[model samples]
Target chain A: MPQRIVSQRIVSLVAGLLFGVGLILSGMTDPAKVLAFLDVAGRWDPTLALVMASAIPVAAVGFALARRRGAPLLGGSLRIPTRRDIDARLIGGSLLFGVGWGLAGLCPGPALVTAAFGIAPALVFTVAMLAGMFTFNLLFEAGSRPRGVAKGSGTSC
Target chain B: MELAAFLPALAGGALIGLSAALLVLATGRVAGISGITGSLLGPPDDDTGWRLAFLTGLLLAPLAVVALTGRIPPVTIAAPTGLLALAGFLVGLGTRIGSGCTSGHGVCGIARLSPRSLVATGLFMASAAATVYVIRHVIGA
Candidate 1:
């Protein structure tokens, strides 16, 4: 392995650890806390908003610094999305995600953390989420594939 | 003020930001959990190794806290099993179609000042607030 890959792996591990720790410490992994934050008509908890308010500015600084350099420290280009168009897919999908988020207060990140506890409910949710992803992949492929595609030729997730 | 949640939330939010910053500096990758996890389901990318490593670190974090502090952070889930399943499914499909999630669109994308992310984030937050209102007030779900 090249030096860059090694550095990337180590840094990624550290970043993930920090993220998980933050989620736990911030009470983001708690469904009740998350739900309370979304409960706008009720006694709303502003902690989640505070979390975003604090995180975004700091992350903005990070992004600005990264953009200043020609490339990342590890010789890889940043993968920030360039598409500026906001279409139906984006709005529709976000609405779906929001409904789910409101229903269970478990988005992808905290859902995985919750699953780490080996609890049955979390486990069930995680499995179902994965299954949902798989189903989407199938539907996406079916919809996007060319009409004249060769047999047994498809991308596997 | 609810100092109990406020202080820790601010500190932890800072920590999360620091990690995201570090990832951008080191790997030029956005630390979007949904995008990362979503990619794992598709064809392999060169970044697969780092993704797996990051996931492993995420999974071990709670254990590390328990090891050092002798306490696992509390988690209270109120939704029933069927609802949980449906919600998980919707989240999975939605994140994929939307190409991001709270971490991606809300945090990382907004940090980059992306307009699409801004809209996506706003829409999701608004919709979530609405959904909560409907569930708790309208139908009383």
Candidate 2:
């Protein structure tokens, strides 16, 4: 039913554009800006907090709507996480991510946006991040997960 | 932050939420950047085409801004190249292990009111702040 309309590619494409532009306009693409936001002990900037806080109300509404719909509007397999157990992996890994984020003021999304801007340093960071992810898949999955199968446990991405 | 700064933060944030909301509403998929990017790696997925298309939009946003707004937002990375590389590597490994980043856990996960996401987001925020404290104030790096 959904195939006759616009494709998933178009939907995702628009989504990414919106996401990228939001990141840029919100100062998220600027590492220094992110650092200032995180540096609550030093020269603090609450811009990031406002961004997140504003984002939540809107996003929460969307999620609530989606949940009430019972299925995605586009007729694809819904993949929201249902896992509830919090474990050490989640805590430790989050700490590591936070450290990395605080260290360089870059995260996956903004890193990609900046890399796309043709910044050499950002490119290096993106490549290294990709390498880290690749290594993790190699060591952990050991080729067990076949291509196209969703990794739907704990969290994805 | 100045009062002027609030406009962009709130506007940009709403847009971000809108896109994520649309992605989930229309496609039943979360727009987790690390997950999207990581999915492209390792092997070809059935949804690779859509994923690639999504990323292309991300790449095109800068140019789009230039054409539409006549200017792009400035990006400043204060970290050295070596440091950036290390941070990127750690972020990659950590996100993969952690299963989400700021966007996933902080935004989408929290929107859905997941307990794990709340915990994860809290931890990441606390840890990130502490790290910044050590780097900027304590160690004064």
Among all candidates shown, the one with the greatest lDDT: 2
Clash count, one per candidate: 1, 1
Among incorrect, acceptable, medium and high, the docking class of model 1 is medium
- Candidate 2 lDDT over B1-141, as tens digits, reads 478979898888998898889888887888788777776776775667778988998888888777889876788888888988888988888887788888888899899998978988898888888988988888888
Model 1 off-target regions past 4 Å?
Answer: A141-157
lDDT for every model? 0.80, 0.82
Instruction: Output the lDDT of residue B47, model 2.
Output: 67
Give all TM-scores, in the order shown: 0.92, 0.94
Give candidate 2 regions above 4 Å deviation. A1-6, A146-150, A154-157
Tell me what TM-score chain B of candidate 1 gets against the true chain B.
0.94
lDDT of 2 at A82: 79
Model 1 residue A128 lDDT score? 79
Q: Which has the greatest TM-score?
A: 2
